[model samples]
Structure formats: structure tokens, C-alpha cells
Target: MYKIAVIGLGYVGLPLAHAFASKYEVVGFDIAEWRIEELRKGIDRTLELSEAQVNEAIANKMLFTNKLEEISTRQQLNPKKRISDNVYHSYQIFFEYKESYYPNSNKPNNQ
Candidate 1:
């Protein structure tokens, strides 16, 4: 099974993680501690996903973690990057994308 890790679990990352959780192992990562807690309780103010959908994702082995080390267990990540001031802030995290696993893919590696 494909292991997936989604960093920056905000509007985009959370939903994407939830979707992937239905098919693969998913781990959601975020810098904010409150975000993790809120998600654990199935709270999404973005109104993108219903409470049922959030809970189902959580039930499907979707772990929300703040510890960046947890991400190493996954093979892939969503291409969703954090946008700050209308520009993509890739500097939020440093990563190396490999072409072997996913050629021409925008998704980043779990490294």
C-alpha cells in the first residue's frame, strides 16, 4: 500500500489527506499544535469537508502529527504548498524531489 504524508494540513492538505486515507495510509503534519488537536476532534472551519468525512478519515488510520520525523515513514506527499502573501512559500520546509518514484510529478518526496 502507498504511504502518504501531507504537510501543512490547512484547507488543501487536510482534504487531500482525507481522500487519500480512504485508499492509503495517510499522515497529516502541521506546525501548529492547535491544528492537530482540532483535527483530532474533526474540526475544520474551512467548511470543505463535513464532520462525517473528517471522522472517517481519522478512523482510517489517518494520523495527525506535529513531529516532522513521523513524515519519514511515508513514501509520498501532496504537491500542495503553503502560500504566503500570494506567493508560494517553499521555504517553509526544505525537501528534495526524486524523479525515480514519480517522474514528472509535482509531489515531493517524504525525505
Candidate 2:
């Protein structure tokens, strides 16, 4: 089973993460603590997903977090595979490719 990390959890990432959660172990990562809290409570402030949809994702065992450590642990659990390769993101997020956990990761180019 692939573990996917969707980095952003805004309009794009949240929906994608929820869709993926149906088939994969998904971690929805965002930098805002409040956003994380809201999602955990089954709230979608961005309105991209309904509260029902948000709660469904939660019920599916999707992990929503702002901590890099949580996603990092998923990488370790699937060490043989590149968890970063499964990462989905919106244009707002950028990755420093040099980051150890994302060695094989590609930083999205908005250009």
C-alpha cells in the first residue's frame, strides 16, 4: 500500500488527499496550525470539501497534520519506496529538493 502525502490541504490538496484516502494511506500536510485543527474537527474553511466529506476522510483514517515529523515517519515506514513521489501539491507549496526525506522529490515549477 502506498502512503501519499498531500502538502498544502487548501482547495487543491484537500480534495486530492480525500480522494486518495479512499485507496491509499494519506497524510494531509499544511503549515497552518489552525487549518489543521479545523480539518481535524471535520471543518473545511476553504469549502473545497464539505464537512461531511472532511469527516469521511477522517473516518477513512487519513492523517491531517502541520508537522513535518509526522510525514517524515511515513517516509520511514515505507523506506523502500519514495513517499515523496506520491506527494501532491498546489502551486503555493514549494519543496527544497535537498531535503533528506524528499531526496527523490521534484519541486513544482510554476514557471
lDDT per residue for candidate 1 within 6-92, as digits (tens), equals 988878998899889999998888866666887899887677788898899988989998776576522343346322322223433
**Runs in model 1 with CA error above 4 Å?**
73-111
| lDDT at position 44, candidate 1 | 74
Clashes of 2: 0
Which residue pairs overlap in candidate 2's backbone?
none
On the 0 to 100 scale, the lDDT of residue 5 in model 2 is: 85
The candidate that wins on lDDT is 2
TM-score of 2: 0.66
Candidate 2's C-alpha runs over 4 A off are 74-111
